[model samples]
Target: MAIYSAERRRLMEMLHPGRHQVFSEVLSSLGAFMEKEILPLSPKLDAGEASIAKPRKALFEQGMTAIPFPVQYGGLGLPFSVYAMAVEMLGNADASVALSVEIHNAVAEGLLRYGSDGQRKKHLAAVISGKTLASFGLTEPASGSDSSTMATTAEKKGGEYVINGSKMFITNAGEASLYMVFAKTAKGPSCFLVEAPNPGLKFGKDLKKLGMRGSKTSEVIFDGCRVPEGSLVGQEGEGGEYAKEILHGARIVVAALNVGISQIAYDKSIAYAKSRKAFGKPISEFQLIREKIADMKTGIDAGRLMYLYAARIKEMGGDYTSEASQAKVYATEMSLKACDEAIQIHGGYGYTTDDLHRHWRDARLLTIGEGTSEVLRMLISRKELSRAQ
Candidate 1:
């Protein structure tokens, strides 16, 4: 089956028929490209035989990263929902590449949302064009996803800021050309755009993972890391708010990503069930198997709708914090269930095969990354409670 399946088409048609056709065509063509070029690399990517940089750069040249930003900063000026859908396509192709690219794009998002015009002109276009690979550096050693407890600090010293601290589990860590670093100032948490090749900036060795092994993850250490005062992206002591805003948008994309993972796993299970024989016939004919398929499809559909709803709200310039968190929590948890069922459908092969079981391994990360389900639930409830009051 095509990566951009009929279900996706029907969903798009339901959303906006004539208006979304262009975006639909773009996604279809991109999906075709990924199936041909990138899908072949997925197994290799998982096994550490291929590099993510080349395929990702090809996507950059395809304007994948450029989709959601304003045209002025070299973006396609498309709605954020379009970009979210594109990420879904990417996730279907390869979760690792999707994860790496989304984190890179998140940095561009920070610049677009909070950076000055000069900063946007200088950094945003490069990131959008993939000329400079970007990394989000908010998660620290002591703080997994909590920005409030980040121990990193930046002190102003004679027209420069000296940063000292380390960030853990940073995606695209060593490979990123630009790092969006958040550290505390006297005021509070602040953000800085630290470029690569700084003498004081160091990267630990790449950390291996259960899945998404294709992408680089490592520790980003800053010891007396001096950057020009201009490196500060926005006002001092507001990085916490900036980080929160960026993550709120990112949660939606993460939802879409998990949906993609679920779709692929479901597709594989269906194909396997049709061929794998049972006591009398193919397992697809079995009632229990049919039930799993139905539930998987339903969950995937619901997850997609949730993210698109949140994405549309965002496009309308409304407050989407609660909606985004809801989508992230629901979609990610749904993905785990879908992927787990897929393994059950495939039975022995799913357990023995790396490529088959990797879906579960990959889906497992979304729950813990970005913001944990527990944390996001609290956030959604807090937002709703405030609204009600």
Candidate 2:
């Protein structure tokens, strides 16, 4: 079934009545593009038969990268919900591509929320327009969730900040032209905009991964990488705050993407169960198989609702940190379960087939990438406890 014409339309109508038509039109247009340009390349992407850059550039040209930014900066200026649903569609098209684009957009989001006016005019437009791909450099080998313990440092040299540190598991690392890097300054943690081709900017070899192979993942090393004073975003010592804000928003999109993966996996399972036979009848006719299908469908629906609820709360300008964390924790775990069920229903064929198994592999990374399921659970409970007082 077409994702846009089905549950997407239903949810859009329930959440946005007056604007649903316009949203649907824009999404459908993007969906059509995905169906033609992206879906066909999934197998090739997974197998290393094709380059991700080609499809990503095609998407950029079609304006997929500028969905939620302000029109003044070359974006469509649409609501966050619309951009999120578009991400879900992209996830269904190709998980790797979706991941690469998601990280790229997170950098744009950082600049939008924290950059100076001159910085926005100079850098944000290029990023949103896809002239320059961006990466978020917040993760380090020694520090994953604890930002305060980061060892990366940025020292003020006469007219520049000399950065020295390493960022691990950075998505779109080698392919990006701009990086929103976080490091320590005298005041505290700070954010900086570091351009590529600097004397001290270097990349480690792309790390091989179990999934999302279509995207580049590598270590970014900043050995005395120097940038002008104007490269500071907002102010020195605000990087921690900016990183937290950027991540809270990103968690919602990650949830939506996982839901998309679940939807596709569930659909494939249903189709296979109907056709594959056992005991002289379709396995789908069996009670156990039917139960798996029902559970998968229910979980996908639940995940979709959770992320959409968080997105709606955010668009309304409310505090959604708890909601976003809840959505991410639930949806990422739910996608894993759903994909596992899909593989179980597919049996031996699923284990051997890259197409069927790739979904599960792709879903595995989400639970650990943005925030580990364990960490998010703790964060959610902490918020609830504080609110109770």
Candidate 3:
């Protein structure tokens, strides 16, 4: 059975007629561009390490550089829905690259929303054009789910604020030109825009992980790193609020990425099942294989719908924290299952690295990164309880 019914497609199409058209064009363009310009470059770089560096320039030039931001800053300023669909397509092709771009967009959106005119002029253009990259520095070594426990401190000095703390598992940490770092100031936990190459800012060696190898993940060490007093982003004591809002929106993006991955895994598995034979016929002819394919397709479709719903809520400027968490948790878990089923359908070949094991490895990270499945469950439970009260 086809998971996406005509009614569902029509509803999705109706969400934003003009924007969807543009999104479709951009997705098609991105797919072609990745095949020719980006994926071909993947071989030259560490399939894992190259995620941060390899596609940064091309993605900016060909993808993000033209969307989301204002025309004044060399961007198309397209609707968020369009930008999100493009992200989903990119994610389907290469998640590491998609994630890197997503992080950049997240930071850029923060700057656009909270940055002063001077700050925007100084930084936004380069970021929009891809001349420079940025990362969000919120997760501390000790603070993963509980950001309130973050201990990174920023002390005031003469005409400057000195930051001393470390951010762990930061994407695009070493390679970024700017970092939006959160720290404890006298006022409270505040955000600071720290420029790169500062004497006091250091990056630990890249941490090896099980998946998402293409995206660079590292720890940032801040030892009395100083930036001007004007470097503060948004109002003092309001960093937490900003962080929450950013994260709420980010959850939707993460869900979209996972949905994309799930769809790709389903497609690959379906193709593989049709070709791989067992007994006297193709394995796909078996009832068990048919059941697996049906389940995988159903999961991917459900995940995609959840993501689109979340995206729509965001577009409507609704309070989407619960919906976003639901989407993230559901889609990521679905992708993990779908990926596993894909491997199971492949049987022995799936266990081997040469087969679709890489997709499985990549899917593993979806459940953990951004926000772990556990954290998301807690978030959803809290929201539900609050509403009941």
RMSDs, each prediction?
A: 0.9, 0.9, 3.0
Per-residue lDDT of model 2, residues 1-389, tens digit only: 77575778889888898988888888988899998999889988999999999899889888888988999999988889888898888888899999999999999999999999999999998999889989999899999988799999999999999999999999999899899999999999999999997999999999999999899999999998999999999889889999999999999999999998888899899999999999999999999999999999888889889899999999999989999999999989999999999999999999999998899999999999988889889989998999999
lDDT score at residue 200, model 1, on the 0-100 scale: 92
Give the TM-scores of the predictions, in the order they appear: 0.98, 0.99, 0.92
* Candidate 1 lDDT score at position 52: 94
Model 1, span 8-91: residue lDDT tens = 878777776677888888778888988987888999999999999899999999889999988888888888888899899888
**Candidate 3 vs. true structure, TM-score:** 0.92
lDDT of each: 0.92, 0.91, 0.78
State the displacement of the C-alpha of residue 183, model 1, in Å, after optimal TM-score superposition.
0.3
User: Taking the tens digit of each residue's C-alpha lDDT, what string does model 3 give over 1-389?
Assistant: 12222433454478777556555556566667766665554433335434456566877888564576788877886766656666666666677777888888888888888899998999988887888888899998899888889899989899999999899999888999899989988888898899999999999998997766778889999998989999999888889888887888788888878776777678778888899888989989999999999998888778777777877777777878898899889988888888889889888888874326666677778777777889889989999899899
Q: What is the lDDT of residue 90 in candidate 2?
A: 89
TM-score attained by model 2? 0.99
